[model samples]
Target: MRYVIAVAETGGFTRAAERCHVVQSALSHQIARLEKDLGTRLFDRTSRSVRLTAAGEAFVPVARQAVEAADRARAEVEAATGVVRGRLAVGAISTVAAVDLADVLGRFRAGYPEVRISLRMGMSEELIEGVRQGALDVAFIGLVPGTRPKGVRVRKMAHGELVAVVAPEHPLAGTEQTDLRRLAEESFVDFPTGSAARRQRDAAFEAAGLTAEAPFEITSVESLAKLVRANLGIGMVPEAVAGELRGLHVLRVRNAPTREELLVWNSLGPSPAAAAFLSGLGIDPSERSQRSGRSERSERSA
Candidate 1:
């Protein structure tokens, strides 16, 4: 049923297998067996594309509902067992987390002491992928506004700005509200190319009608801070990360972009632990169900 939902959502067996993290052959075999047992074809396949058969259109909604109901039943059972206690992997964008992730985790620990929480930080894209692939329960990320990825649900958390960072002893540290073009001639140690911080930096440069070259790309915000502290180059980071680095001074950009922060999680097949975490955070589960229902409706009417 999960496979069927994935197939319908993604529109191809190979893509569905990727979403489900299974090999294409294995996913295909399972669907074939299901069809053989049900005595109807679920999909129409061609060399270039795949579409749901009429039978598939009839079955996918029920399949999605079944999968969601099973998840809810399991979560309810676990909730009744006592406290919400299980391992949960939580991801955050390294530079900015709207609610002070450590504080939230501390409170969550105080309430559900038995729940083992692992926090990992990286670029928004990578962390979102971690949540989508079921490796992480939830994430706080810098999301592009007005866009939501399939297979997960997100809520806008906050909009915050990035600041140019330099060591206190560096030449640019004393300047306030510096125009970004001033640094166009300086070396830059920045986030990886596709990271939210890097994108904002690029936009800032464009706004200034200048280009800032990043000769060194670091994945971790801490690493970028260290490099900047060592006089490697100027660094661009969120205000929160700058606060953490000793002696790092923040220089404001004239027209820096405000990051759209979001709290995102896998809605399709949330584990009991993930569901509990969301509930504890007061996140509504109905949004996911509604989104799923809409997708299933679209597929059914196709």
Candidate 2:
């Protein structure tokens, strides 16, 4: 199954064999034997290309799950004997503030040299879904206040509010304070509409019965800051994130939206590597929240 999955992901047999650390001929022989046993061709090969047959498309996902389950089972047994070994898949939003991700990952690698670590940067909603679907073992996400992600175990790490950020020469620069209504009058540059990042501020404007226009849609926090620094339009970002961005004037907004930083993992249970990561962060992986849908707060030190 691992070989098949490697082949599907790599898109060819030669590369898949190299990745599997086996000769191409042996890998091909094994695949052919498996296909013959199953009475179906998993891939179609030509002189120029190799692609999965319809049957192969249907088989790869299950194959991946089986392979992962086998690996996890072995890792769990090893962990029971006081050793950790397995893959750790982590996801997070680009603008994480409560915990320093790179530093955390660096420390984790130092402590668990045998564990393979992978990190993915995405929007909050997508990261939540990744944890729920088992594609990611753990995730760090930010959500609007009073909101909670469904179907995953969560722990609140910290809470923060949004602030207005403008270029140094903008009219709002050097201003200590502003409100949502006042900021609504200015053009804005923000995340794409309908995204959770965009919705954080959008909900505030909506509650005030106002509509703010963000003509430039940006998908990344860094890009949005760059656009704002160029005086294209003003922007709203988490207060903690604003402090880290150089060359921007950060202002406190009276009615700014607030968000909560959270750590999420599979509700069923965390993988061994994930459990180790949680423990390293001083979080108890076995602890469950008593607040029903909402997770309890467990802040980490910087």
Candidate 3:
């Protein structure tokens, strides 16, 4: 199963062998034997490329789950003997600032050297989905105010308001403060049109009965700052995020949109490695309930 998983993920027998620390012929022989036992071809081999057959595509996920379950059982047995060892898959957004991930991860590694860590960076929606699917053990996601992701145990990490940012030479640079309505008059550089970040900014303008245009769309805060610095368009970002960016004039906004940074894990529970990491964050995973609405609100506040 491990060899098949490596082959399916790496997409070639040669690379898969290298990853599994075996010779190509040995890996190939194992896969061939497995396919014969299963009565189906798992892979289609060509000179230039290797691809999963329909059976292989269907088999890979189940194979991964089986492998993970076995590993988890082993880790649990080891934990019973006073050693915690397993894989920790963590996901987060690029603009995360509620906690210093580097510092936290460094500490986690120091304390749990037996655990292997993998990090993935993506948008909030994507990261949330990862947590739901069990592909990610834990995630840090940023959402618009009042936004709640389902099927996960959540803990609110931090909350902040968004502010308008403009180029130093732009007209709003001289202003100390502005409202969303005033900022709506300018072209904006923002996250994708329907993204949570963009929607948060949009909600602020909408509440004030205004409309804003985003002619420049960017994925990262640094890129948005670059566009603002070039005078291409103004932007809205969390106050904490804005402070980390240089060369932009930050203007306080009246009735600014708010964002919530949250820590989310599988609703069923966390893996042992995930539980250990959560403890480092001063969070008690056992206290988190499967229901993550009002109960979550109360827990986070406490």
Candidate 4:
């Protein structure tokens, strides 16, 4: 049956044999054996071509469906085994996750000692697609301003405020707070244009009617932190990320928009390990908003 499908796809026994990495004679023998067992002529043979016979055409769909079903069954078994012992692929943007994801993941690992976790770091856009495509069980990404993809669920994990980070000894770092207009006057370490962070930064600057002179562009948050530590120039980063840097002082800007960190996964459902991890993080998927509201009310009362 496999040989027949291969031959049908390849359109020639010799080509199918080449694809299957066997001699053409061996392929022909196997097909003949299949025909004998089925008692039907599966293919119409000619000097120039091999075409599926009427019976072969009828069998093709059933054979394809069976193959697909078998493959899905195997995948299901593997996934079920992963409930206790399997790998979980997770994605994250470099700068955002550097802040609080370590603590969350550490707690998750402590709770699910049997499941292995692998982390892939990339930009927010790429990580979103990865989650939607099932390449990643979950991802952490900066909240895109307006656009959202279909077939992915998102939860607000944390709110991140944009702040200017500078070396502790720098002049502006000593100020209690800085306005965006004054901060824009200094040479800046900028993220590449079109990035989520850059877009938010641009919007803030636009609102303030200011422009920044950014001679240096950096991609990594760690590298940006190192740059600030050297007193090279100031850069805007999430407060959580900047707080984690030892030598940097984070200053709040008067009116910068806050960036939200989100936990994203396929809309169909989360893997068991991912659900377990979220549960350990104190996030109930179905009741996140209600829980958040209750916490807010308790805080206000307190």
Q: Pick the candidate with the highest lDDT.
A: 2
lDDT of model 4 at position 198: 66
Error of 4 at 68 (Å): 14
The clash count of every prediction, one per candidate, is 0, 0, 0, 0
Ranking by lDDT: 2, 3, 1, 4
Looking at model 2, report the run of 10 residues with the lowest lDDT sum.
Answer: 293-302
C-alpha TM-score for every candidate: 0.67, 0.88, 0.90, 0.65
What's the TM for model 1?
0.67
* TM-score computed on alpha carbons, candidate 2: 0.88
- In order of TM-score, best first, we have 3, 2, 1, 4
Q: Is candidate 1 or candidate 4 better by lDDT?
A: 1
Using TM-score, give the best candidate's number.
Answer: 3
User: Can you tell me which runs of candidate 4 are displaced by over 4 Å?
Assistant: 1-83, 97-99, 144-149, 285-302
RMSD of each candidate?
Answer: 9.4, 4.3, 3.8, 10.8
lDDT of 4 by residue, 1-302 (tens): 67788999999998898988999999899999989999998999999989999999998878865764464355456657654445567888777643377787787787777678889987677777777666687888775343344457767766756888888889987786898889878988867766765666777788788988777777778877888788888898887776677888888889875676777776766656766766766666454221233222110100
Query: Which model is ahead, 2 or 3, in terms of TM-score?
Result: 3
The CA lDDT at 227 in model 2 is: 95
- Candidate 1 worst ten-residue window by lDDT: 293-302
lDDT of each: 0.75, 0.87, 0.86, 0.73
Reference-based lDDT, residue 117, model 1: 84
What's the lDDT for residue 207 in model 1? 67
